[model samples]
Target: MNQPSSEGAAAETQSGALFLMAMLALGTVAPTVFWGLPVIVGQIAQQWGFGAAELGIAVLGEVFGMAAGTLLMATVLARRPLRITLAATIALTAAANFATPFAHSLALFIAVRAVAGIGAGALSGIAMSCLSYTKAAERNIGWLVLLQVLWSMALLGYVLPVVGATAQATGTYVCIGVLALVFLPAIALFKRAEAFVSAEADNSARVDVRGVMLLLGCIFALYFGVGVLWTFLEQIGMRAGLSEARVATTLVYANLASLAACVVMPRLGHGNGLRRWAIINIGACVASAAALTLPQTPDRFAIAAIVFIVAWTGAATLIFATMPRVDTVGRYATLSPGVLSLGFGIGSAAGGELIELLDARAAVGLACVFCCVSLLCYVSLGRAREAEQDALARASQS
Candidate 1:
């Protein structure tokens, strides 16, 4: 990813607003298709004659692209104007995804997904950067959540049909491509001045590798569990005698809870909000693990789904919300998305492999352990802050 530069205009223009909205709209489409993959894997695999290993490889292609794009945006584009980067990525993803349904062979399809993955990765990074650049870092945080809500809404609308109608996957892919096209024009509209904020020339803050590692650890732990649960949740539910309709309803309920939380978290105060949200995320993970242990009846399933949603949404908000805060530490704000992408990649890889080994209940327990580690790290972080504050006060008194 590129770093923020001092050369760009100080304020955003109407063009930037349109650009942001476009990216947010397109962003949801890809992920909806992504999250819905597990529900459709059997159909896709059967159609494409894919073995488990082959299928996993295809998924990894996409994950690798995402990680690559995220790293590029964070390190390379962090210093550049975001509009250009955003437009290019959206265009690339849209084109690649549009070509996906027409692939004649599994290899062809995987190749298309690989390219699309890179595009999707860049799209996520650039979209996030644009959102952060819109105004003061503080205000952009709410805008960021709002962007997520919009994407989630789009995901909900697109995913339901894809899961329900076997015929919807091709059309869904094409539609996402079209959605990405819309961002091109919006990118043109964002004011040049508002596109890149200048940094202080004399500042020499060093990067906090430990902080970055900790934050990424948090994301990895959370998403890894989610990846495992999502890949097998429906399969497990069905094997346990759940009706397709009931299973679908459970997914809907979980996402709806997540949607509501995404909207609410950003509207709250800042300061310690990230810390509180981080703690909530750990709690959510524990709840989700507990949910998996419950009996597999409709009511129990519904409760479990709720726990999963709480955990999913809580961590997502905490991770993204804390992103800009890294700017205070060093060049991390520019590099954060890439580090995050790397974490997501690791999680996706590990999660996929883990789900293949453990039952859903056991998988959840393992995930909870990871979340507990994250909670301990965060709690210790808070204590360190308190200790620093006490020392500062004493020094001032002297």
Candidate 2:
């Protein structure tokens, strides 16, 4: 791979690594809070003397805060240099986590959670921006997706359980706080890369409305569709008459397969190859959707659906991994996640409401519709990229 040999590249790479590590650390915290909260909600309510309704409201406040933070970070990173913004965001997120346990009242708890969301969103945006400044810029999408998978797996596999076992939310918060501190060194490395900039900043790289719209569509359809499985995976297996062990195994297989695919997808191509991979993924989703609705049988339905989940995850990895490579990728790298998060939040909310009206099986159909929409977006992106290439080639020949 070609890389700048300037004193800056070395420093930037170090910073890039730190930024990624911080992202993994900070991202895990938010998800942990969300997932772990339900398991411990009763304990929390009893200790604080709050009812279930209040707890639900506190969770909502946190999510809203997080969404706002992401939007604000997207705009901020577009105008400012990255290192300063990155470090500040990390510090803010860490502080938010540390303070989460100290909220004595429901209102105070809700307020803190919202603040934490902003910090988390800001940290995520800066981390994506930092990736654009490194040697890995060309493969930025893959790296970001991989980091997300790793973070998600780590949190689900380890962190939440540890926190639950501790019976104290403080330990989990501190683990992430210490992690935020580790990111400071990475910021120093990023400064070195900025000092060696050779070309003027590309001005045409502002967020593209069409590109962002496509990404939003993908997020909404994919996340909302997949949510049916998320909200009812265990229930589905039980309803199908499978043992708990089988359900757990299926979930593990699904996640592990996706993680492997995300790591591999980015390495498969340098040009529009991601587009091809995306097409294959769409097929996988279709198959999975069909399998999900089939009559339960040990030999047919259960196994096929399990395979389908694994396939869908791999397909999702491809979609997410290709995101950072969009036309104005460098620009969107910072903002795309926020826009995408908005899609996810909207999708989740909408999907939940839709589920109230439709059964889980019907919800799978909704997911299929979402997947089809995402496929169209990918097709559009492919055409736009081809046009851009043709124009560049013509200019070069002249």
Instruction: Please write out the lDDT profile of model 2 over residues 231-255, one tens digit for every residue.
Output: 5666656666778888777777766
| Model 2 segments more than 4 A misplaced | 1-57, 132-151, 192-208, 299-301, 349-357, 387-398
Q: Which pairs clash in model 2?
A: 66-117
lDDT of 1: 0.60
Model 2: worst 10 consecutive residues (lDDT sum): 1-10
Q: How displaced is residue 218 in candidate 2, in Å?
A: 1.6
State the C-alpha lDDT per candidate. 0.60, 0.59
lDDT of 1 at 62: 72
Candidate 1 lDDT over 282-336, as tens digits, reads 7767676666666678777777767776666656666655655444322344333
What's the lDDT for residue 13 in model 2?
Answer: 57
